[model samples]
Target: MPSRTSRPTRRTALLCAAGLLALPRLQAAPAKKPLPPPPDVWPRPALVPGGVARLSLGPSATRPQAHSGELPLLVVGDAIEWTALVGIALAAPPGEAAITVAAPGEAARRVPYRIVAKKYQEQRLTVSPRTVDLSSEDQARYEREREHLAGVMATFSPAVPAQLHMQVPVPGRRSSSFGLRRIFNGQARNPHSGMDIAAATGTPVRAPLDGRVVDVGDYFFNGGTVWLDHGAGLLSMYCHLSAMDVKPGDQLRAGDAFCKVGATGRVTGPHLHWSVMLNRAMVDPALFIDA
Candidate 1:
């Protein structure tokens, strides 16, 4: 007996044909492109009224003859209630003023910052007689020290990156506040330029962020001092140290031990005087730290 020839059922044939027709159409569809990364959101930390933003200033802002050195960059914005980070750039002689923004039509704007340069007068003190006396020789010494410090401050590279996080150099209660109206011996003096951390002698002082030691010296007023450049016109100074563990050009990391607290300079007691300077203007360091 001849077996019945197998044949394709009409329903099965139609289904197969339809599937074959769909294959080409599915393959012809366009491929999907990838999505872009998200935009950066800045942390809105509360800033003191008239507080300056910490940022880097590039080498182009400084003298061209010197291929290397840091230029101090300070940020001063119009006094406003909301907190925002401002970027600043300085142009050489024939300086033109203009406001630039990251986006067009944005309410936030940058304005021309007028920085007035002032010459600081130096006073000398004699330890033996416990008198604040200025001798010709002492005056000369003070002038030399002042010049050296000014040079160091000038070398601050505006190219160095700003510190993203800040911590107290040592665990202590804050005493003398930064920018306080300070009077010494019945005479009004310049406002306090740095924050004073009241800690016992020998307390370890740490760096608040990664940076390079730009200057270190013992001065008549600052006592033992260390300045760290954390890029772009942002520099940190630690003074009145009993001991210094780092020197100029030494690289340091955030929270690294840099010195020990002391009352080395003209101070009441052992404490860490921490300062942040932008474009030579002494600004409050607390604005950058979380605590």
Candidate 2:
């Protein structure tokens, strides 16, 4: 008997060749790109009517411009990334909605987003007939005010707000909520566009964020109202105030007392009607503030 030389079988050689063939494929495979971070939590994204939609614009060397139809949107973030904060109208029908985004040096493109339907509660109340059925003079005044407010709401300034999170303007009970289909007596009216905080008359109403007083006046319905421009298309309104401490062009820091609560407007009692408007749409103020 002689010692047989050890040799690889055909099957062994094929297995070795297969292993060699797999090495380059494993080595040449590229690493997967990382996902982006989530958007800011403030003005929490709610894809419904009377909600704020936070649409990520990805990264860019400069801030991109966005718009809802003809109305410009508030695009915030740095050169590395940008986001569009759009205010969904309370009357917005649920379905597909799109916004136009135009990055620097690039052609504008439309980005479609989905909007879920939301049903708000209806409220019935009994008030003076005079408030509900306006006189001819009051009607004319309201029309004028509406025209003026249209301009105010259309304001889209260059400055972006420092922070999206907001503090409550006053400490009190939430007497009324936004998006309520209010009915006075037996007649129906538009949905309540703001949050009403119940407080004693003369209670200080402070600014929730840094803003410039853009409009202050005694309106026909709102009484003593103050509008604060928080830069970009972000504006906050304080309505039914007894007194206004800040005037147009007056700059105010967060927590600065800008007005006092009152029952001056078409209200049953003293309360602060706080509203947050973005891109001319009156969104639910509760979205920006903690309830």
Separately for all candidates shown, the number of backbone clashes (residues 3 or more apart, or on different chains) is 14, 0
RMSD of each: 13.8, 6.5
Off by over 4 Å in 1: 1-50, 53-133, 158-163
Report, for every candidate in turn, its global Cα lDDT versus the true structure.
0.62, 0.90
Candidate 2: 10-residue stretch with minimal lDDT = 1-10
TM-score per prediction, in order, is 0.61, 0.85
Model 2 steric clash pairs: none
Most accurate candidate by lDDT: 2
Residue 41 lDDT, candidate 1, scale 0-100: 26
